[model samples]
Target chain A: MDLVFAYLDPGSGSIIIQAVIAGIVALPILFRNRISAVVRTLRGGRAATPPPPSAPPTDDRPR
Target chain B: MSAPRPGQGLVREPGSWRDPAGFVYRRDGAIHRQIAPVFAAEWEAYLASGLHDRLVTRGAVLPFEDAPIADALDPATAWRVIRPEMLPVISWPWEWCPGQLRDAALLTLDLALEALDAGFTLRDATPYNVQLRGTRPVHLDALSFERRAPDAPWGPYRQFCRTFLAPLALMTERDPRLGLLLRSFLEGIPLDLAVRLLPRRTLLRLGLATHLHLHARAIGRNADGKGAEARAVRLSETRLRALLGNLRGTVAGLRWEPEGTEWADYADRTSYSDAATAAKERIVRGMAEAVAPTVAWDLGANTGRYSAIVAETGAHVVAWDIDPGAVERHHRALMASGRERITPLLLDLTDPSPALGWGLTERASFLERANAELILALALVHHLAIGRGVPVEMIATFLAGLAPNLVIEWLPHEDPMVRRLLAGRHDMAGGIRGNVAGWPLFREEAFRGIFADAGWEIVERAPIEGSGRVLYRMRRSGRA
Candidate 1:
């Protein structure tokens, strides 16, 4: 099927530009922890890993 | 919205008008989404793909039953009408806690990737497409997914960025209050605005630099044009998958730890004794059980102490507070405990979420959407009365309008919390000119009289020992 599928419309182009830019900007921020971990390992030191996120204190009981 | 036909018995929802694929309508107290003719092919493909079933099984997508309305409103454009399971409550992105937004962002990315695997992709990445089914995030827009082309970039990428990524980034890095910007920007925060408000240090972060700063510039360059120049850039399936993976990774890594704020650690500083707290809990529990409401709203649900107790009766509770930190902490606790009956939202009762969008009818206001059977205003009246300076009668009027059954805690002026709220007050009855006297004392009779005038019948009144606070279980007259 030689149908000319104009999938990328004007509206779509605008959306694409936003996504591409956002995706590129997000790469470093999102993977900073891993990036730092790798950098630490290359310098012959263990990565300073953060502890797992904990639940908030549920007990609102007074002392 | 289009005018309702003479006797079709259908009212099209205002918010869903933006999407060309279809519009949702309410007919005889049931929700139905109509598939338009333009999107018929896509809709057919989506049903045949089995992805809907897969998503429904995971509780990721809202499950719908195929109930085709015979006498269609406009049969010319209507393709297929299906009835969907109505969510108990509809919460917007601006009201979500940081943890909830992060989870929603991750869920969108996950669903997009999964859709790609099944030869379809989400047409848009708006957070409005997702809604909370309790603590769990559920994708509500069934028509959002369309057949994906081999090397075409994701269409909803920018929307996803604006709606989910941008808000999440700002909330995580700068201040959680930044999430409230969504209420202002109905179409999601502009990239230019986000980049400007972000900290200078964020430039060091690669994600912020490229996506926000650089993305803003790109958008600026193509502002006058229809993005025709950049339309030639074809993103392959491999790259698209990688893109989704990156989004998932970034969203997953962005965590906002709820640090102690004014009301986040309120429970620890309260003057109530252990026995008093227990007694109060028992009273609240007993009152909540008596109402046996399907939905309950807990106003000023700081750290969700009483909200959790209310949820014990198997009622879906919406824990609302002004402090983002408190809501965030409550949300995290709920998530950790695997409790899915309560939703913690940041809401200032004074200036609640307003009815916004076209003709101010699209996204209903907090009070409009929230029509709970039971309302719990525990330890909240003083905040509105003294701190915010809302008159007692006005508070009673608003509370009465919120629900039929209400459990409100009234603290006398002598109470430590109320005193602290009034300590720095110089207004003193006569507008800062007359005597500069101390805070005016709030009497129980005055409070009771106000509620009575507002058509509330007091059912049970319980007092916390040594706290000078009274809890009233009041039912609106003519409602019971």
Candidate 2:
């Protein structure tokens, strides 16, 4: 974070816009699992099965 | 005494780390002092005495008054109030001209003498505490003095040497312009550096030996142990007075006359006819009148020719130039004319003052403090744009950040001065491309594009005949 702020020139608005985009993309990914766990715990763990992932994961296994 | 009024918005100035005992704040455009409750009794007694009035009247210290304590109550740690006489501009020692630094040093010694006589001793002795009020020096930190240290051998001796003596010695012995070292070592020139920088001949001088040479050795030896031997050398009041007198004599003996520079003789070499000069002055006066700035900065102000015109608009003008000789000439002109509002300082815009001191909070960075109402960058952009290889957009952005209003002069490469700078430079392919090619490659459109990028709007532009110099009036989008 310190590096980001230091490197971002105050006069350049593009750096700020890039930072906002990065933040948006990373925010939900960082908290999605923890948030779901908290929601389950708060509901007394009634939903024992896990929910599906937000997006399907692609696989490329070596034969 | 009661607690301060709520919502008075008297936030402590964040830049008082050098002073640990008290802090300064601004409320309703008036400066206020807040003494730490630990030293309340001493502060009260000091104020009650006539010493405060004496110091203020003699122009040694900033004047202040006891403010009415607010009714909101917190008996413990209640802060004292003082409305100090505001300084028009606060300049650090690093930014000070050699004469100003010398004056501040003398003023500090004089204040120390007076404080001792008043049964007090100066606890802090940093050049940052002193500021130029007109040509004279005045102490800005009133809380630096405390009750007399009857036994202490000038408790602030090390600080005094670091801040004043070392820099003065280096400036006098090596080069008058070596004072710029203060900008690098903000806590005062490092004693170790000074010891190395001083000439071998300096060892012969008793003052240099006792003050700087021995002082640095003492600091190194006593880095861990108790400083008993150093403290053993005590001065009687008479001896201390003599020491101060000696310091004054030493400083008085040291002098630097800005001798030779290319543009120092610009007034003589100018091709401008008398009528042309008058016309330029008229345009400058018109711009100043239009802006009516309270604080103006004139960049590249050669001998303060246009700076004087800006000051004529009743603004406090800070004239800055890269050439010390030019600044010196401007200062002499001000002295001769008895002009109080104009202050000439030496500064190189390509490399301005940076954040310095402990945690970079002691003295304000140049850009942090350079918030002038009007900035006059006359005949300056060409040097930055062509000579030093700075982009025109970057220059515009920097200027826009400094002031709300700008009076810039665009000098075309066709001008003889520009031709002189372009001489003897490699014409590599990558080096000179696009508008960078040919002197005066940038047209008004380029200037407008850069200014617009920095959120500025051009109000007017007047081109001078046969000179290829155009004066512009621009305002920041927000306000004057």
lDDT of each: 0.78, 0.69
Candidate 1 lDDT, tens digit per residue, A1-63?
A: 102223223244455564565445445544654565565466444435543355232211111
**Candidate topping TM-score:** 1
Tens-digit lDDT track for model 2 on B33-141?
A: 6666767766777888778889888778988777765511222444776678876676767666666777788888878877877877777677888876655678987
Candidate 2 Cα errors over 4 Å, as ranges: A1-63, B1-8, B18-20, B28-30, B71-76, B229-233, B261-263, B428-442, B478-480
The residue ranges of model 1 lying beyond 4 angstroms of the native Cα positions read A1-63, B1-8, B426-441, B478-480
- Quote model 1's TM-score for chain B: 0.94
Q: What is the DockQ of each candidate?
A: 0.08, 0.00
Q: Indicate the worst ten consecutive residues by lDDT in candidate 1 chain B.
A: B432-441
lDDT of 1 by residue, B21-75 (tens): 7788888667888877778788888989999999999999999887655644455
Candidate 1 CAPRI classification by DockQ = incorrect
lDDT of 2 at B22: 60
